[model samples]
Target: MSRQQLAKLDQLSTGQTLKFNYRQNGVPREGFLVRLKDTWVAYENRCRHIAISLDSDNGEFFTQDGKYLFCQTHGAVYEPDTGLCVHGPCKGANLFSIPLEIGESGVWIDME
Candidate 1:
């Protein structure tokens, strides 16, 4: 795995999201880091159904009620626990996983 330092965990806050790019197979791919329940979860931003970004124009990718991550492109609802597309067109689909670990310093993107 290629090494890409996204950001420090303390730099993020609950309900916030940040975008980062990593080189995979020599191609730069974008992903997202979301702060949820005082922890960070990372996943490829592309939706499984149409390969479109889940976030809207402003990078806001959550439901109005802030319960789940909603894909604006096709209205897919993903469960944060597993990055599984639990509702909408891509039901049973799952987002690409990016392993992450947390510590006293911050969260780190596991590139292993």
Candidate 2:
């Protein structure tokens, strides 16, 4: 596994989600990072239920209320911190989490 630098902590604000690209088996894939309170959380952009991106448009993961990650595709609502699907088609499912590291310089992810 190799770690890839994601973004500077100062670049993200509370409740903000940023999209990132990483390579898997030499194929580029999408992931995302979200700032919740003072912590950073990350996950693959795909939805567990339908294998589709959580966002319908760029950087639109959170619901209108800004409380949960909402998938417009199938109405899946997820807990941003844990990636747990709380409601919608795939209840009891979860988003695929990507391991992340926070350093003094920036955020990093295990891209392997």
Clashing pairs in 1: none
lDDT of each: 0.79, 0.88
The residue-by-residue lDDT of candidate 1 on 28-59, one tens digit each, is 77788888875788888888989877885468
lDDT for each residue of candidate 2 in 13-53, tens digit (9 for 90 to 100): 99998999997777788999999996999988998888888
My TM-score estimates for the predictions, one after another, are 0.86, 0.92
Off by over 4 Å in 2: none
Cα displacement (angstroms), candidate 1, residue 62, comes to 0.8
Off by over 4 Å in 1: 110-112
Model 2's alpha-carbon lDDT is 0.88
